[model samples]
Target: MFSGAQISLYPMTDDFVGVILGALGALDPYRDKLRIETDDISTLLVGPPEVLFPAMRDLFVAAAASGKHCVLSAAISRGCPGEPDDPICRSDAVGGPVGPLSLRKDAAIAAVREADVTGQPVAVQFSLYVMGTGDHMDEIYGCIDFLKQSGVFDRSKHFCSRLRGDAGAVFSTLNEAFCRFGPGAGHVTLDVTVSANSPTAI
Candidate 1:
């Protein structure tokens, strides 16, 4: 299996880079066959599927808790190691009546297993498209009523979400939320997972 990760460093602090490098070193033994290549605000991690997955999670959690604004992106290719599928984990958008997308239970457990074992925060991937339900004018917003009524909202720049929570809760809620759209309305396919995460520029 092959896995890759990308992270975005926030707050743009001088101390941030050194801290993450140190933490990742501490996690070396726990991380399965991990490697690093870094730039100014991002890092790249590539490694085995199982080990890379969790290592990425642990690294980001450590970096974030260390008092830095950090977000991550990652992908894991299971079995084939060379070929991987696109599975989105979390998505935020404005088109449909719905406000945001979250996970169900099935996807959550699998992603968490990778996070728990490797000690890295999870990575969520999402792509928006119609799901074959709802009104045509509804367009992107499948649940137009729900979007206006639901109090769920965030202030992030990307209409997508990357979260870390209880192994089960995070993935399950994301999956469930996106699929909630119906009857001709499109939905985003979420493939959230954990890997040996590094910053994109680093």
Candidate 2:
């Protein structure tokens, strides 16, 4: 039932420090909604999808808006092993109500759309690992099937699929996967590594 994300931002520009700092600032407003911690390598955010996805969208949009070649890499996980099981990690943690999927999708889409307006399309690649289940492979394949039919997947990659399209659609697809594979009776952990950048940059 735990959900969290570890993210690292790399701005491919001379002003990398400034760009990264600005991107981090985008999460400031949501401090109350997330448990955020930052060190030299990356920032960790623990919270529900309602706040987490929007925060991610805003942070990426803010960073991409700099028009510098940048890459945002994230590890989003739920029910991880050997981790403290605290309220922040729990899906039922006391916070604002979770928003509808459509609303979350809209937020991500808007951010990506804003970036796309600058004439650059954002590209994202991610691998989802569903663990702790007896039929893990079956669940994984089921999820993959769902993604392929979901209309947001790139279809060119497998096992580790490459997602390419409007940012919002990509994020929405990701969010759905995360939710579906989260902690359950037979399922224990869902780990995802996501890397995003501008199409021309990478």
Most accurate candidate by TM-score: 2
- Candidate 2 lDDT over residue span 10-110, tens digit each: 88789999998887788888888799888999889988765776677668778877877777788876666656666655453222343544453444344
Local error of candidate 1 at residue 122 (angstroms): 9.2
Residue clash pairs of candidate 2: none
Query: Cα miss at 177, model 1 (Å)?
Result: 13
Off by over 4 Å in 1: 11-14, 30-32, 73-202
Error of 1 at 198 (Å): 20
* Per-residue accuracy of model 1 over 56-143 as CA lDDT, tens digit each: 4455556655545455443322223233432221122212354333322233334334432323343443333343345534533433
**What is the Cα-based TM-score of model 2?**
0.75
Question: Alpha carbon lDDT of residue 171, candidate 1?
Answer: 35
TM-score each candidate. Answer: 0.41, 0.75
Give lDDT: candidate 2, residue 39: 93
